[model samples]
Target chain A: MPGTRGRRADARRNATAILDAAVECLSRDPDASVADIAQAAGVGRVTLYGHFASREELLDAVFARAMREADAALDSLDLEGDPRQAMVLLIRSSWRIVDRSRALLVAAERGLPHGRIRELHQRPLHRIERLIERGREQGEFRTDMPVAWLSAAFYGVLHTTADEITAGRLDEADAPGALTGILLAAFTPPGQPVPTAD
Target chain B: MPGTRGRRADARRNATAILDAAVECLSRDPDASVADIAQAAGVGRVTLYGHFASREELLDAVFARAMREADAALDSLDLEGDPRQAMVLLIRSSWRIVDRSRALLVAAERGLPHGRIRELHQRPLHRIERLIERGREQGEFRTDMPVAWLSAAFYGVLHTTADEITAGRLDEADAPGALTGILLAAFTPPGQPVPTAD
Candidate 1:
């Protein structure tokens, strides 16, 4: 019984290792082959396929891992408070996670099917939608623009800011605040002063 | 001789056809081969080789053509008037051109070197930079943020809007105005009402 358990534990370790290697390899090259991933993982191709049926499956697992990490990152934020302040916190927190997973995100974007991409994005999109609705209810954000559109803009701006930071065009330290300012200005009613976040 | 002049005209026509084919093929498949482009252009591999020595040369021509088109699109914008209004006009005009060249832009983004990419973007970036600076001098925009940052944000927002529209996530009709509104709000000083373009 003890020997059987030990073998199972080893299998689990191998699966984890292979997944990590696949993520790293695919992030570097979205078209990386199963052989490349196996070599990166220090496992044979047979072992890699034994765990994941195909390359598509491995990509799905990578995307799932990325989604889980991002979900966990976002879940820690208190999205129920002063909606405006909550939004600023969310922007800063989500951006840090995004910056870490930048490569994987880009790879997933290229590798995932369009529907699958939308599916992966649903949770975060819903969270943003609720936050926008909350802000609208509190009159903290403009009511004329659709909440959905504002949410879309929120996601869009985060991505653009991330790209800027990655390209060395915008300082990493400046991104969150810069993003918060842009989002706030866009959401707040025209003629109202946007409260500066220091 | 008359025959030589006719042959020269034929060569010019072939070059134009080849460049257009490269743009079309690369836009569809960033990894498209020289042969694919030649086939699309209705020319043989030998003829393609005669016109461009290498695939890299053809890609450079494609990128150059894209840049030239974008520059012409931007040139038509009066970047001088009331800075805010001029920005609105510029966004609408630029987005139209951007919409047309979306495929080429994405292809160049993946194919060209970073330095080459920056070189291609120089004209538009400078145009935006000057517009932001003018807005600041006119007291139409906030002076706290660097002009360069504002220009970058302007470019970023436009690309985001374009992507959203292309993906069918945001409406095409709403794009230009939504873009103008978000950008103007981001650039304007706090407490000022954003001028509506409609």
Candidate 2:
């Protein structure tokens, strides 16, 4: 157990260092070479390969790290407030990730393994679903529509809002309130109380 | 006016021919060369230049044709039966355009003189706004949300659904219904009657 413990700790350290280097390289240039990443990580080519078999695996790891950070943010997000306000906060937080990891997203768009990421990406979405479900049960969200559809619509707005922010068409500060108002209007059940703006 | 009439007829024919060739070429390959387009249209490069001036202008014509087609589809679309069903039909028609002219969309995404095309793109969106406004006024759509965000959300879903279709993750036939359900849920006014699925 002692030897196994030491090996696990060492592996974690190397993985962290490699991911950090990958993030830096991708931020500067999405098409950064593996050799450059290894150099930055102060690890040899073989060591880097040992952790990630291919460039795609390395990129996937980098993407997963960003997603993990996003999930961590979700962990601390307060969803107990009025569902509409809560959703707005969640979306705004998600936008911060998209903004900071712009290069990673660009790379993913060019051609990253999507199947692997879809499940990881669905984590935040599942949380949104729960909130929508809560709103529905509380008579705040319309009961006629399925949660699946609401989730898709939520994702749709998030995508467009992110695009607007990236393209400098809309100020980031205004996106949360704007998107929240729209979602609230779209999702609020009839006769339910509307949440006051934050 | 006899000589003037002949000249006008010839100009109209040439413009129509240019637009037809542009649609064919852009749909097949958005990045197709101008020389190729001229050859396909049976016109000299100089004549093509006389008509369109630049690649951006030609793309603008291509997008205009697509938008016109979309607008025409809206006229024929039967959104009268049920709001949700009608919305689904509209989304389906839009998806067909995306499928048929994916190459052109890729070109648009790459960079089409955003100024005029962007304005033209908003034309259909403005029309959608009117539809949504009508729905809200009629108590079919939620009244509290800005139509602009809902419109953007619709466009975003269209883009993503198209992307999924292009990538083969989602079948084209299933997309409309799936997307329609989500949009209807998002847009239905609180306390308003929800349509039962057929």
Candidate 3:
């Protein structure tokens, strides 16, 4: 029993190391091969294959890992607060996770099949949809647009803002606050005066 | 002299046909070949080569044509009105132009050199920059963020909104109005209450 437990721990450790290494490698080069990933992970090709049958499988694992991290980040936002404040928290938290997962997301978009990619986004999308619905119900967000379109726009702006940060057009330090302000302003009920200086 | 004039007319017609076909072919498939474009244009390979010596030259012509069309579309917008109302007209007119040139833009991103692509965008970017500056001068926009970043964000949101429209996530009819409202709201001077419900 003791031997079995020790072996299980070893396997788990190895898998974690490989996943981390794969994320790093693939983020740097989406076209990286299994041999490259194995070298980065300090594991042999055979050992890498033992854990993931193919490069596709390894990429899937990396994408899954990134999704889990993103979801975990979202979960930590204490989403039950005031809808406006909760949204601010959500934006700040999600942006950090996006910054960390940038390379993984790029790699997945390039290498993963569309269906798999959509599946990976499904959970996050649902969580965001629910949040938007809550905001609408609470009268924090305007009811003019459907929750679906607003959710889509939310993602769209986040991505564009990230691109700006990456290009040095926008300061990373200021992005979260700026994004929160822009999003809230855009969603304010039509005819409501613009937000006053806080 | 008559013979020369007749030949010039024929040459001009052929050039127009070739350029139009190139736009259509490249938009449909960025990887399309010169031969494919020539066939679509109903011009012999020899004649196509006679007008443009290389594929690169042909692509440059297609990009130039698309830019001109976009510029013309912008020209139609009455930008002399209230800055905020002017922005709405600009968004609506520019979006229609973007919708038309969507294919060309995608192809150019894939096929054109980065420097050349940036050059193509320079004019339109300047136009947008000027519009933003005018808004600030009129005190319709916030003075806190740099005009440059706001311009970048403007393009980013426009592109994302375009994507949503293409995917049927946003209705074409609703896009211009939504985009204008969103942009105005975001740029409204800080500390102002949200716009009254119109």
RMSD to the hidden true structure, all candidates: 4.1, 8.0, 5.4
Model 3 accuracy (lDDT, Cα): 0.74
- Residue range B1-198, candidate 1, lDDT tens digits: 559889889888999999988988877876789899999999999998998998877888888877788898789766777988888888788778877776666666555553466567778888988887888889987766656666766766666566566567777777776777777788877667644424
- Model 2, runs deviating above 4 Å: A1-90, A98-155, A162-174, A177-198, B1-8, B78-86, B113-117, B190-198
Candidate 1 CAPRI category: acceptable
lDDT of 3 by residue, B1-198 (tens): 559889999999999999999998987887689999999999999999999998878898889878877887686667886987777777777777776666676566455653465466667767878888898899887776666666766766776566556556677777666777677777888766555322
Question: B89-133 in candidate 2: lDDT tens per residue?
Answer: 776776676667666776665446323444666766776677788
In order, candidate lDDTs are 0.75, 0.70, 0.74
| Model 3 ranges with Cα > 4 A deviation | A1-19, A26-38, A42-61, A103-120, A196-198, B1-19, B26-38, B42-65, B103-120, B193-198
Model 2 TM-score (2 dp): 0.60
Model 2: residue B67 alpha-carbon error in angstroms: 0.8
Per-residue lDDT of model 3, residues A1-198, tens digit only: 559889889878888889989988887876788889999989899988989998889999888888887887687668897787777777777778877666666566456653465567667777777887888888777776656666666766776666556556678777676777777787777666655423
Error of 3 at B106 (Å): 5.3
Docking class of 3: acceptable
lDDT of 2 by residue, A1-198 (tens): 559889889888888899999989888877788899999998998989999998888998888778888888887988996876676777677767776777677565443643354555778768888999987777777665557556655765776676556556666677666666556655665444444334
Model 1 CA deviation exceeding 4 Å by range: A1-12, A22-40, A49-60, A105-119, B1-12, B22-37, B49-60, B103-119, B194-197
Best by lDDT: 1
Better of 2 and 3 by lDDT: 3
Instruction: Give the range of the ten consecutive residues with the poorest summed lDDT in model 2 chain A.
Output: A189-198
Q: Which structure among the candidates has the greatest DockQ?
A: 3
